[model samples]
Target chain A: MLVIVVFVLVGIVTALLWASLDAFGGNVEQTAGVYSTIIFFVLLVGTLVTPAVSGGAINGDRDAGTLATTQVTLATTGQIVLAKFLAAWTVALTFLAASLPAMLFTVLAGGVRLDTLAASLGVLVLELGVVAAVGVGLSGVIARPLFSVVTTYLVVAALSIGTLIAFTLGGLAVQTERTQTYIGIDFSVGGEFDPVTGLPEEIVCLEPETYSYPVPRFDLVWGILAANPYIVLADAAPTTFTSEGYPEDLFGQIALGVRSAQLPIVFDEVIDECGAALAGDPNSAYEFETPQEIFDRTVPSWFVGLAIHLVLAIAALAAAVARTRTPAGRLPTGSRVA
Target chain B: MTSTAAIAVEGVARSFGDVHAVRQADFEAASGQVTALIGPNGSGKTTLLLMLATLLQPDAGTIRIAGHDPVADPRAVRRVMGWMPDVLGSWAALTVRGALETTGRLYELGPADARTRANELIELVGLETLADQPARVLSRGQKQRLSLARALVHRPSVLLLDEPASGLDPAARVDLRVLVRRLAAEGCAVVVSSHVLAELDEMADTAVYLDHGATASAERIERSRATARDWRVRALDPAALAAALEAESIVTSGTDHLGALVTVSGEAEAAAVLERLVRAGIAVSAFGPAVGDLEHTYLDLARGEVAEQPVIDSTEAPR
Candidate 1:
């Protein structure tokens, strides 16, 4: 049922994007956008459903009085835990599989790159597994099924939305003052018309105006965004750039947000419009780095986030194994073996 | 020391934090015999069985099942030990046969063997009618039978049944008793813990009485067994029976709806009292101990009268 829901939702989103992009004259950018959107929805649904499926794996059995019966069998505690984790992982993956047709439709439209596809799908699968593992692990560690299921949801929420909130607040908490000096072009005093330069032949400059304002130091807190699962997926995918050096799709767009955060705020900036006008080029003063350049220069944080997630998953399962082992040394409060 | 003893516990103790669930439990159950773990509620009977089943570790002292220490080598013990917990839990999503088959596979049986074993257990437990139905549809008694069948999937040599007869119907209870006896007769060591002393009285060959997390010492058990208990006497005429009892100077404890209750010291005294009632020209219809043997001893022990009595010579006492 969950798989069917995933397929329908993903298919609808894909179809909507396809129709809209086609109306706007479909291209590689539209196809890439479609692919990224579908993958994102799949990840969202996968994380949301995994906790419900896996969160009661162990403690529920204990409550129902079946845990000890299995414990008495030849299967060890580790095997039982691992089996549950695997089962949950497989179940979670079926949600991904359900979105495959939509992803394939986008792929057939000719925009999603091979490396981007491989990396995003791989990370998405692993991320889903991480959630499943955490759910099963928490189930074993906690005494009650309801509490464990809720705890698993909280963990997912912490990783998904909490990181974003932290990044925003942390960046804002430490503000830096930035000074801007603007040298305006005195259009009233300039003499007429040089069509080639797109500026007046004689230009008069006004006194430079200086202003200081506070800017949030996002560079100091950008690492927090790296912990977010969506950001990890965005940052890890190989981004493609348009001919003018702009991001072509949603992944690059989100990746650009985090990557640009890595660049420190310039304390002083000068807008020399009058100087540029006098030098016969009016727009040269506003030439800035493109999104592609910023992306290329910033550090990739996806692997770090993925590693942290893996460690968290392993730790939860390990704790569960310790707690669920029979000939159990000690039991959680108010829990019974059988 | 019976070298053939399938279960041996020496000073076994276990506690849940401040609540000592089992303390200083000591007993041995030999193969080919049914040992009843007799106790009242909160008496640690289930806790002791958990230790023997390899699901719990003793806090102090040792437990050996089939010559293997459950604490040190639970796997070996589990290979031969089957436990039916007092809590009847089943895989609600699976059918009765599927649960048994899954349990057999968990015990390391191959797929074909598991299927065969599941079929045999379904028949043995008399759940053939409900074999294809999901466990969630089962009543408490049917679930109990499924749990028993699962425990027997691996053909364990030592069986530990905790309150196995609690939810059983009378006919099912008789089948369970017969099946348990047959298992013991086939050289399996069976330890049954239950609140139903009368059922145990009919099925158990010997009993280990536990009270307050401790097993009654053998000497204490003997003393309790020999303590004087009430006997019920029913005659054709209630007046004649009461007169005969008074005429014989037999102390009548009380009278119930059935007949007159007299306190008899032992089997010899009970027999003598019956003979006198018959000789008094009163047709005695019922003449027997008021309670089963295990119930009498259990009651005596529970009432703390076992320690006050000196050992009595009850050579002819019916066990």
Candidate 2:
């Protein structure tokens, strides 16, 4: 059943990519977009399917009466737990292997860089392994298979979507007031229009207008987004930029969103249109930074998120090993060892 | 502990929170002998077996399988002990052969040796016809056999079987008895726990009685053995048999369609009663103890009718 689900999801993504490639003639940027999109979807499907595949590995064996038999053998508790984790990880990797054709096609289209491919695939494999380890570990620690499976799903959901929700709510909960001042030029007083400057040679400025409103301080809570798996994947991949210093693919685009969030909102701003007109420099009133500049200026947080995930996986497995060691001293209430 | 004893348990007690599953179990099973662990429901037979199997630890007391502590050195104990739990569990996805082969491998057998051992066990347990079939397809009896075969994979010197004959047919039960005896004869110490006393009577050389998580003391077992028990006496003429028993001053407990039951003190009394019946010109058809030895002792212990006596030597009761 898991294999079928993986194949169907990969097939749908492949068909969608193929259709898009036909509609818009495939270019280097488009092919790169296709590869990034494929990797993202594959990661999505892998996380969704991994819990059901790996959960209930140990407790289910106990329920079926096979665990005690294995326990009585020469195999130690550590060996048994490690073997289950490895088996579940292998099963999860098979899902990644299922989408190999689509990934290969995108690579052949001449867009994906060698570094981007290596980093994304490596992180994808590790993320899948993390999920598998947690699932199998929870199975041994929890007494019932059903509860373990649900708990595994909750863990995955917490890392995938919970962080995003928390970041948004945290940012919204802390609001700040911002003031804006705007000075307008009076066209009624202009004598003659300058051909080069599109503004009157003589200008009369109106009274400066000032307004203030509350704004969400996203900069204060943007660190919470660093814990999200999607954010980690995006931030870890190498970004590609266009000639205009804009992101070209989905990874760069998502990374740009997170990187741009790091900048603090300007509370005081001034728009002196009359002053600029007086100086004959109408374009000098605005300041802009491209996505590429944001990407370069912000700190990358994928390694931190990956480290946190690795620690969680290891802690879960270690707890399971401690609980499962025998000769078992204390069994969970209402649980049978055999 | 005797040098020949492969399993020596002393004051073994295990509890699950509020429930004391095995309070004070003490017994020794010698190699080359079949020891029957006889008990009624909730007697902690399975708990004791688990401790011996090295799957559980005793809260107080020590268990030695082949002279190695199960709790402290389970690896050594496991290397010499094979346990078949009362609950039958198999790998549903694996074939019978595959399950056995995997068990052998888990015991640290080489790949080729594991395969050979699996085939040999399949034939030994009469599972040749279903050897290649998935374990999920097996009936309760077939699964029982597979579990037994898996236990024997490593050919340990000591074997622990919990309710081994529950789901077996009469023929299969007979085969099981023969196989168990053969294993014992091969110098393997076998401890079989079961409620089927008559079956154990024909197979086990000695019996251990457990009641309320404790083994019956030696004096208690001896007293139970000394109590008078019923003997079935059948003759060609029921009237003549009753008259002959009356003349011989033997009290008849009851009379059924098959025969008249008379309580006898021991084997000598039973023989005297039969001799007197024959001297009275009555033809005896069948005459023997109404229940197996283990059943009588078990019933006596369950009834709490054991006489208070001084502790005697801990020799086994007459089978």
Candidate 3:
């Protein structure tokens, strides 16, 4: 029943988004970008629902008095936990499967890159599995069903939103001072101004003025974003660039946010307008890097985040197995094996 | 056929934090007999059963179920042991047949064999009509029957039944008794723990009395059995029976609707009292101990324990 509701809701939302993008004369690539954004939204909803699906898998059985009966059977604790993990993962993946029609529609629209599609879906699937595994493991470890389910949600929230908050606060906490110099042409010194070009006929340079200001050192704390599931999804996907070197999709845009954080703040920047005019050059005072350039210069931390999540999942499952093993050495308070 | 113990525990002890659930439980149940684990409400019967079922670990001693150590090799014990817990719990969403089949599968039975076994167990437990219904809708007694069926899915040799008859009606209880006896006759060692002494008296071939988280020693149980207990002596004429009892020098404790109650030290003394009553021209219609064997022994042991230690153990109550 939940799967059906998710399917219908995703279908309606996808239809609305596609119609809006088409009405705005969005090209195939832009329409595909909107579709990816819709999928990301679906993934967010899936994360919330997956824990509910898997959170009570083990403890619910125990509360109902069925866990010990199964444990007394030939099945080992490892097999029981593994089976529950597999069952929960399958149930969670159903929501992803429900959105397949919309995904197919986006694919048929002719702008979705093959590598981008593979990478995004792959990460989304693995992330859902990780959440399910964590939920099942916690259900085994905790004695009560309600508390375990709530704990699963809290863990997911910590990864999805807590990491973003930590990264922002950490960057703000560490500040660095930067010195900048400014120089310009002095038109008053020239005999007559060139009206057509809005400049002096004879170039005259002004004195260089320098000033210092505090800048947030985001580069120092960019690694924190690697733990965020959304950031991991966005950053792991292969980003597409337009002719102007700007990202064309939401994945690239969010990915660009983390990549931009990696660039060090310019401490001794100089706006040498007077020197440029004297050298007979135009637009040499401002220097900026594109999203693609920033992406290239910085390291990809999505793999690191994924590895951390995998390790967490494995550790939780191992603890659960130890707790559920029988003849159990010690049980949690107010709990019975049979 | 060998005279080995089907279920054996030696100096077993278990505790939960400050409360010691089972201080020392030592007993052996051989094949082809029903052993009654007799104890009061808080005597740790269920705790001892859990340890034997391999669901719990003993803090101290060793347990062997079907010749395999439960702690060292629970799998081997589980393969030959069936436990019906006092608490009845079933999958709410699954039908009775479905639950049984699932249990069979968990025991490594094939699909076809599991289906066959489930059908057989449903019939044996007299739940044919409710086999297809979800277990949630079943009554307490019906759920108890389902729990029994699930435990017997693999036809285990050593059966542990804790409070198995608590919720059963008279007819169902009779059926359960017959079934349990039949299983024992088939060479299965059955351990039944219940608060109903009369029921155990009817079914149990042997009795193990536990008091204050400890099983009473054999010598202690024998001494308790030799303690003076009331015997009911029914007669056609109440006046004549009372007079005969007075003449026989047997002390009459009291009298109720059925007959007069006389205190007797042991079975031989009770027989002597009856012989004297009949010789004195009293029409004795019925003569037997006032309480069931298990109740008499259990109460005597409990009283002895309290008398031995005036400071009552508050932890003796059930959790």
Which 10 consecutive positions of candidate 3 chain B have the poorest summed lDDT? B310-319
What lDDT score goes with residue A262 in model 3? 88
lDDT of 3 by residue, A184-302 (tens): 88878887877776678888888988899999889999999999988899999988888889888889899999899988888889999888777766366667688888888988889
Candidate 2, A1-338: lDDT as tens digits: 67777777777887788677768774878888888898899889889888887899999998889999999999999999999999999999999998888798889978899989998899899999999999999999999999999999999999989988888888899999999998888887779888877787788898999999999888998888787777788888999899999887888998887888788799998988888877877567766788988877788988989998899999989988988888888887877778
At residue B187, what lDDT does model 2 achieve? 97
lDDT of 2 at A245: 98
- What tens digits encode model 3's per-residue C-alpha lDDT throughout B1-319? 2338998788999887767889998888999999999988778898899899888899998888888999999999999999998878899999999999999999999999999999999999999999999999999999999999999999999999999999899999999999999999999999999989999999999999887688899999899888999999999999988777777778988999888999988888888888888889888999999999889998888888878987355554332
Which candidate has the highest lDDT of all?
1
TM-score of predicted model 3? 0.96
Across B1-319, the per-residue lDDT of candidate 1 in tens digits comes to 5656899899998888777778789999999999999987787888888889898888899888988998788999999999999888999999998999999999999999999999999999999999999999999999999999998999999999999999899999999999999999999999999989999999999999987688999998899888889999998899988888888898989999999999988899888888888888989888888899999989989878346655332221110
Per DockQ, the best of the predicted structures is 3
Error of 1 at A298 (Å): 1.0
Which one is best on TM-score? Answer: 3
lDDT of model 3 at position A128: 93
Alpha-carbon shift of residue B136 in model 3 (angstroms) = 1.2
- DockQ of candidate model 3: 0.66
